[model samples]
Target chain A: MNGTPEGTPERTVRVVIVDDHAIFRSGLKADLDARIDVVGEAGTVDQAIAVIAEARPEVVLLDVHLPGGLGGGGREVISGSATLLGSTSFLALSVSDAAEDVVAVIRAGARGYVTKTISGAEISDAVMRVADGDAVFSPRLAGFVLDAFGTAPADIADDELDRLSARELEVMRLIARGYSYKEVAKELFISIKTVETHVSAVLRKLQLSSRHELTKWAAERRLL
Target chain B: MTTALQRPPLVRSSDRMIAGVCAGLADHLGWPVKYVRLGMVLASFAGGAGVAFYAWLWTMVPTADESARRNARRPASPIAPAVSLPAPVVREAPRGPLPLGPLPDGGAPPFAVPAPAVAAWFRTRRIQYGKEILLGAGLLLVAAILIARQFGVDVPLGTLIPAAAILGGAAIAWMQLDETRRAGLVDKTKADQAGGWVRLAAGLALVVAGVLVMVSGSGSWEQTWLALLASVAVLGGVALVLLPWGLKFWKDLETERAGRVRETERAEIAAHLHDSVLQTLALIQRRAGSEQDVVRLARAQERELRIWLYRDAAKDAGLLADRIKAAAAEVEDTHGHAVDVVTVGDAAMTERHEALVQAAREAMLNAARHGGGTVSVYLESSDAGSEIFIKDRGPGFDPDAVPEDRLGVRESIIGRMKRHGGTAVIASSPDGTEVRLGLKAADTAEARIGEEKP
Candidate 1:
């Protein structure tokens, strides 16, 4: 009991699926049924906001593109349901590997992102981690973050908040190489908790650096 | 999706001499406004049928602004109903718009005025050489008729009116059919303009001579009415015979346009498939574990699909980034390991750029063959030059451990870069090997502008 809590004592995590494809949502629900309780589902921005508000699931798997609402896609769903952010978490699930799309949802306050190609087990794992207040960074997202924060071997960054410490970059690189958190800890000769801390630090930089390069990236892509 | 857009609606034009009916008809039929106005005046002198037709058209057609508003309000594409989010919506097959009934000539106008202002003025005043000559001729004809009447040779107005109506109607119908036939023929500039004027003059002369003959050899009112009704029935029979052929022609044009649109839609679908399915396959290859054959098959399929989808771009694959990808794809095929290429910007291919690509290729081959894990190739090209990093995650080997003859890392990668006036840095530790290849541009001014603290 005194040890660190492991994800709310193994209770099944409640989740909502938000995708335009009904077949994909049903398939994903069947795959995650053992660990994840499918509380509700929605297909568009308005429906996603309504369903998430009503169910208040622990985690919501959101598609990056959806019809309805000012054409903002998943980012609109997140912002439209801002009040639920304190209780529920959002994880962007998309087929798009576009950097602007990934960064836009993250900036709009998604806990993490995972591509649709991820195995059901991996996605369930990501959902559980997000439910436990941990940020999930897929390999592609890590690469995008590295590129945005300028991996040019410069310690002093142009923007103060956008700077990644030497240790954070190492953690990000290992993650980008498809290392699990446990594997990253072993590779870096650090504890699993320390690996989490470094990843969290990188994530903070990713969110904070929004005003600098990431915002410019989204603007140049006409995402704004 | 409507013939409303294809066939310009018979709206009253903004350019007006009186009611703008003639101007709008001129625009719709692709004819000169002055000629259309003259035809309307001649028809009016015959029986006032022109006034009646103009009123019917003005009441029937919508204005341009109303049509624009209606089009704007039409929903572009139907949005899937959200009530059935748990089940996919079944959509009905799209129906093609039907071709409408034939109207005036579809040919482009011959005398396309170069400027709008000048064209408007010409339409209203028509103060050119032809107008003056027509006015003088009209005055001479009136004087001759008046002198004849004074000499006791009366012109029969009653028979003349009926004959003029029939002749004028026939002339307009013939001119419309002639214009349609001419539209199907080859387009000629100077010849078409001259021929158009000649045809108009001939048609008018024929109508006027026929009316005069009917007046001089006057017939009773009942016989004139019977002849008009007979001509109408004959023209109706002719139209019924040609209706099917005209419908077939328009249908062919619509099918061709629809086919072009379908082709573009197909290209978009292919791009979408590449983004989703190809990416999914790449991810599967990364985690396929014991199913090496499955992973290799998926990788090969993905490579083929990507190349096929971007075949047009591959024709001019001279960018440094494209060359690196071609090399990475080669390594992936031969060594059965995945190579993920992420490029920032592209530069034109140069001889030194070829060295970079070759060195990068050697580094990738070493990583795939020896490293035994997925290789990551990152290329960044700026104004100054290009920088490529080929990194792998397998257990690294010391450079000194390799024998003299097996000098792929030292000779093929590092040596190749050195000979090409570029620098290659090999950093191998217990974690992995990272080969950084940098090629500086020869332009000093650009290099200075792109200078940054290394």
Candidate 2:
């Protein structure tokens, strides 16, 4: 739950910023310093992995494009820090709204994705959510997921692993249509916890599908 | 047959020997340069006719570059215009909303060359001779001919007859040069066609003349037959020597064509970027004082460009998705709100769906006016029906609280859908409002069949 007593200063989310732009990192660190603890910062993939490893931050804010590490960028950082993935959650922060890069890092184990244009307070909220073990889906990411999984219920029985449950589909659609988790809960007549559970379940199915249909879908569309 | 009237404009070639007169003549008449030079030298002895003609050609012929520039207006045919970049994604400064779709890349065939290899066989340069080397050979040949004439070393009639036959045969084979070159370029002007006919006829006349002289002047028919056979054999030998050169020429043409395609693609991409992204960046910079305006401009441009890039994949998305996108865009532009549209599957816009689109547009307009931030529009067209969800993160308002005159939601969205045999559901709470428009398959036969299946 995001609700916590204001008196507990130790409840600040430990975070690492991974972006190639130093100015962006500094600006973000300054903006997020009030609510989030900026434990480490890195500008490249190798640096990101090293800093994340050293800091053992609760959440890593990663840029989709990085200067190093086999040219896979944020995906490489997430995979490289696979050991820390169990204890440390990774959240993708990018300026690109491209589906390919977003899907790539998500497939590589990013807990959530938020665009760079997001406000500092909003990004802090996303960080806290990821730190709380919840999958944060932006409207665009929700739309991408809906497109990849396909929203039609007719063929749901054929592809068990790739299909989204009816409830999950409803949740994803609401999110895609720019509904916040709290709003989605209110609209669906469910609790905020239930909304988070549905999103987490969808995220699990996205990662667990044998054939990453998301990547294939994006590739087929030449989004890659 | 060899009429000089209406001849192609004689141009001095850059690839030349001496004054390029002989090479120019060879090019126009489809004869070998060496043979034409030798013929001219021999004709010079006939009252200096060849020397006078060469001087005239040197004075009259335009240089290669001049000819090339002059021919700029000439139809460079056979190459269809480069695949036009999908007619600039017509973006209208959003009065309301903009339409979206991908332009199909398949526009025109890139090159019309029938077969580069085959065409190259006739066009390839079989001989590469230096200017100085050709000049030296010409001088030596002239000296030898003059010396022989002075010594009165009577050349045998037998040798002279065969030499004539050989020259005639060579001319006949050379006629293919211009014809094939025209074919290769695939831009045969009427003059070139007429010239080709004349060259063929002249070649035929020469061959006939050579045969008649050999038949009449020789002592025996066997000698004449033997001379003709030897001429044919020489032509075959020349062809054999040119085989590798033809192949090389073919390869060169292929490489050149590939390069042309790459250049075209690069130019198209650059033009698109300049028109869309660069222009948007300029607009953003000009309006930099307002952060909101800058963000709005960038976001709209980004969406338009992305849709254009993925136009191919979106091509089959049909009218439903495009209509919804346009609706979302209209709201965004008019209200300065961000609308995210994601579409899955597509179907034809049946009459019933018109109500669906209108309702969705109304919903989006409401959301933008009331919803403070980004609005999401998700459209899915499947076998059953098309479903559109227009959700907004705004302070929820009760449908009944609004005055009866505010017919936007009640009359436009809800009433419009109900009249068209569709359903509209509005879910509003403290969090936000979601307007779902569902239109069942009224006219789609496929959907009717799909419903029958289960």
Candidate 3:
């Protein structure tokens, strides 16, 4: 839950908060726990990508609307950092709960989505979840994702779900349904390392940045 | 005579209705004011020709005091006593049916028409009257010859008739020319019922004469049909002259009516806004501590304004649901509660729809206040009706336990639905509480009837 494996020391979760508003960034930095290190901050899509790549933070709190760089907003920041996707996971912290915004960022590889009205503690928890490879969304945003990616998988022939091997699909469904990696490995009679490999492959094939987005993607399509 | 001719006409403001145009015309033409006004009213009924002429004359004439001021401003030339005086003296002249005294000095009113312009006008009038007289004499001679033939009198009709017609036409032409030439030197007097009255009476007489001609011609129908036809044609020509004025008046009246209707509608909207939205805004201003309360008031005002501006757009179910979700989001943010809004199917956005959303919002607020955990909202709509359910997973209370002063439930939720002819049913137990608000399509009929009552 704290982004550390069992038997390991409690390590700080390195985070980079990306938002256009300076006051919000400062307030959020002030509010978070000392255990969570604030590595860098960025006000635009290009700055976000550059800062995330340079800092190599474990979690990036990205806003949906940014000033510059491709004009694709948070989606651009996420897609622009394809090389850093394996290491740095993104949790969208935006003021918009618009369905299109939530779905677009998720489809472009953000780990989760939350509105700006969320309490500092809730945002900190979401950051830890994204760092620990879990999909976290504000309550209503999950419905938006679910509605965007229709419930029935019958219309998902060209969907990322169709590209995964059956074994990977099995691991995806269990993980998306909130099972830990060890639990998923145990369910499938595979070693933890093999499960991790399959998860990474599924993430790559689906263009997902982390296990969190993989879960959200699978959950939205109701694969769970 | 020269002094009398120098005086200008005045637009008699005392005896006037709607601009003094008729009175002005009467004073300028040396006619009795009452007869001129009556003639204008009759002409208005006959396609409004008199109204047009009166409006023209109104602009052309000067008011009594205005002419007097102008005369005083000018240097006094050597003129007789009457012309230099103001209009009150002229108005005091004897109110006879005929224009009294030497044609009022036989010159045009200086303000109404310049001396050179009057001379030209008289010249044209003389030519027109001469032609009319010549035509009249020709028609008379023709009629005389026809009557003779009808009476079986075989007199030498051709030479006698042609000679008499020429001589009479020449004599009439000579008299009109001489009068017009004299009118240039002096103010030409007008009869009591000149201008508009003469035109109106002429039109009426022509119509009556046509009817008589038709009735008399019925006996020797074939032989005398031309006279009847000529009279009818003249009546039609007169009617054509009045048609444009009547059409113009009709158009003006229609535009005025439309403008009045628009004004009334605007006033109604202003009153409604003042009564409801403005009052709520004022109350919110007084109680400005809570941001949530302010937000709620602002959202209510926004919804009202949007409905007023884009009523058609507000009627779309999708847009309505979006608005409700937006309101729910604001509540969740302000209260720090998790609200899950799930909508199934579409319902038209009516006043009933608005009522249901408001009731649902109140229910959410109640649950957030009295209960715990996530607040869940479920909206199910079908052709029959729409049902909204707000649920909270927490300890519940009895409805009767609510205090008498708590009007949130009594007015905002339950009363709202009842007003819209819908139902709000709340069920609660120790584990959880759910407020079910149902609005049937049939209830819209009742709501409409309620609207009609006020």
Candidate 4:
């Protein structure tokens, strides 16, 4: 129930292979098995869901259109099938990479989407990424995704204080040293009450939080 | 896909709001319109918001009559924009109306037309479309700018300008295609017109916002962020929305251009054919006694014609120099000695003009050869009609004097003159022979507009 240590390699990534086309599934299974031990290979979504429940593969290679796999006599959009795959990281395998197709799948909970025309190596990489909880998408689709959802800034610099006086730094260090209002007053030869005022001034100048946090931060950075 | 769309719905295929009409129609057709309408409604509503739409319906129950419900299940054909024509269909291999046999002779026709069908198709429609595109683009530009202005917005135009320009140019281009399409100028398609406006709108909005974000002291660059997002959004949106249409437009343009080129080549081939190969075939047909003989002789003769037809002629021989000079001189001086002409060595053998000159010179020679002569030559490049002639005072003979191996009668007199796009005629026989050669001059740049129709 507890979290593993940083960089711990304790968990095995399970995978489920699903495709309506038998030959494709068989071949995909052989490849996945040889590369990264698949939990189960299901020829259809029905079998795959059953296998997924039984084996609990972390990844499922979800086909876009699964014939008769929707438990109905008709065909549905690839998105409908995606929603049925549950929380298992769904890596979409399809022959279509149309902008609409890519967006539809991603919007349908597919962790990764790649065209079937891709080489075995690329497919393997895509599968691995999806299994590892990373979103894999084609370049255009990725752009579309970023376009639809506002993009986040990659770098955020901390605010700078350009005009703080040099005496402010000494006052900030002393304040960060965990000295009491009275102790700092004696150490710096300032009035005890004057020390409290300097501490307040230091907080405002350096944009630091309360004195307790400042002490811990100063101790970590060797600023005291 | 086209065929699938043709299928009629259970309802009136008029609207898509409810299941009543679909249900009634389904009952009539022994099918479930309710389920069908449900599926269709689900599919249609799922386009952008399926869940939210259903939830809204669940809360806001409408009080409508049963008959109105019947109306809702029908498809709304009028609301949907007409499907843009499919991308130019890639024609399968074989070209031309029919394999009218191999490339014909007498060199290719000089005035070959470019895609006549495409030209003819776009001739009337292009101008109308181009104007629409222009109007739409202009309106969209004004609207977008005014809206942005109204909102107190500004944006950098550097990036957006290019996109708008691209659209504007495409719109204006409909007007320019007349040269390729023959008499008809630009015809913008619906897709083209829409795309142009959309482009202008997107560029204007995004650019204005982007500039505002940069200049004004906005709280957190949200305007610039949105502007950038808007620009990208417009690009993606327009591309996704108009890709098939734009592609179809481009393909049509390309095909039209291609059609023009192909048509030109075909015309050239036809002209060459009519001038030589066709004439030659006609001769063989008349001469050959039996079908078998015609077939056998045609194989050899056709091969022979195709063979010598492609010889290397000199690049820069002064073709028709004598004719041009003689004709130019003829316009001024009327009563000159019957134009006496001479041909020096192989002058500009490869020049197409040389062919006309050769024909003219041959006409001159034939006049002297047949009946010594009073000949006159006249030519005009700008003033319109171009002519060449030969006249001499000699024992003027009649047409009856055409002897066998008569180069003048067979090749020069008839074939040569016709091949030059002119005719050779005997003007008078009053103590002198006068031979005249005249050809119609092309008013504009000599062009061919022909396209093969399947």
Structural similarity of chain A in candidate 4, as TM-score: 0.50
TM-score, chain B, predicted structure 4: 0.24
Best by TM-score: 2
The C-alpha lDDT values of all candidates are 0.69, 0.72, 0.62, 0.45
Residues B205-227 of candidate 1 have per-residue lDDT tens digits of 55644554474455666765666
What are the models' TM-scores?
0.50, 0.63, 0.40, 0.22
Work out how many backbone clashes candidate 2 has. Answer: 2
Candidate 3: segments with Cα more than 4 A from true spot:
A1-11, A146-224, B1-345, B350-362, B372-387, B391-395, B398-454
Q: For candidate 2, lDDT tens digit of each residue in B198-309?
A: 7677666566556656555755777766766787798789989998999999999989998998999999999999999999999998999998898788878877886776
Local lDDT at A63 for model 1: 96
Clashing pairs in 3: B106-B186, B106-B187, B107-B186, B107-B187
- Residue-level lDDT of model 1, residues A46-119, one tens digit each, is 99999999999999999999999999999999999999999999999987646788888988889888878666
Give the per-residue lDDT of model 3 (tens digit) for B90-112: 23321112121101111112322
Global lDDT of model 4: 0.45
A38-143 in candidate 2: lDDT tens per residue? 9889999999999998999999999999998899999999999999988999999887757788888998999988888777777878888888899989877887
Identify the leading candidate in terms of DockQ.
2
Best by lDDT: 2
lDDT of 2 at B239: 85
Return the candidate ranking by TM-score, descending: 2, 1, 3, 4
How far residue B251's Cα lies from its native spot in candidate 1, in Å, is 18
lDDT by residue (A1-224, candidate 4, tens digit) is 00111111444456777777888877776654234567777665566666767776667777766655555211232333445455567777765423344444544556655656444555665565555454554422323332222122122352222222344333332322212234345557877445435433432322322223223433332311
